[model samples]
Target: MLIFWKPRLALLAVPKTGTTALENALASSADAAIVNPPGLKHCTVRKYRRDLSGFFEQKGKRPLSLVAVMREPVDWLGSWYRYRGRDALAGQENSTAGMTFDAFVQAYLQDNPPACAKVGSQAAFLEGGVDHLFRYDRPSDLIDFLRDRLGQPVEVGRANVSPDGDLTLSRQTRAALETGRGADFELWSAL
Candidate 1:
């Protein structure tokens, strides 16, 4: 997460959305940047409203507008599967090594997904609401907005990207994912 005090805007770092690149580009201009410990780096809007909003908005006397980037739901899941399957995570319990995309997705739709499919939902992360949202597939929308909001040109390069891989899923599994995680699709579509 990043806060631009002058703009009274906060950027929530949504996972699998190139947030790291955006943060790297915008950090210098931000009044503060939370970049360590995955829990804090990827703090949800709900957590912010419950824990930190008061400190920044009430005590600071500024009501900050929140912003985030959301990816197409299926693509987001694909990224998660690919990321966990990387060689670095080969022996880890959360690794997706030797797993088919369909199997990974099936586990993800479970009420209690296995570690490999435990990536949290984008919809749940932003359930508290946000003032602005941009689509991961639409880079210019975010870049242009940041340029204006930060008063400078903004550039983002790929960071923490997963290696190319097949993300194929059977039709039945696809249907299950769409049904199980509908909110993610809805939220991304809104962007």
Candidate 2:
């Protein structure tokens, strides 16, 4: 017989999804400890318990569950691109800096592509078996859900700044995310 020791509830931080804001809120409201990811000096732990079966494992002494907060793909992608593109273009002049949004989107999808290896894919989230997912677009919803789950009133506030530029994905990437990597999002959009 195997026994599973549920640790505390694990919060899987997805990048650029108002995670920092939510982390601050949860940290203040619930007295939870936020674990920064390894290597990256300033980032949340996006991956949790790989052996636990993607998003399925929680490590604590009780039956623990998982929770995540994500944003609409369009906004999330745009913010991500600005943050990253600025960094990439820091030292280069006329280095595709003036490219059209469409061209940038094309390059983005082709080069980075949408993968769980970087950003948290919806497929990964669905397969991770998280107990509940809160949309960052609506913080109140997350707060209410967290209150019920954690047995405390968590104040979810707007802490992170919105993205600086338009972050719409190129047509190809949009189509793929809508149909492939983000099929779950598509379904949610339908409902």
lDDT of 1 by residue, 140-184 (tens): 998889888878888787789987779999999998888889898
Q: Best lDDT goes to which candidate? A: 1
TM-score of 2: 0.65
Candidate 2, lDDT over the whole model: 0.51
Best by TM-score: 1
- After superposition, the stretches of candidate 1 with alpha carbons farther than 4 Å from their true spots are none
TM agreement with the true structure for every prediction: 0.97, 0.65
Please report, in order, the local distance difference test score of every candidate based on alpha carbons: 0.89, 0.51
TM-score of 1: 0.97
Clashes of 2: 7
22-111: candidate 2 lDDT, tens digit per residue: 667665443344434432212222334344324233343344456666667656655655654454545454233344444544454454
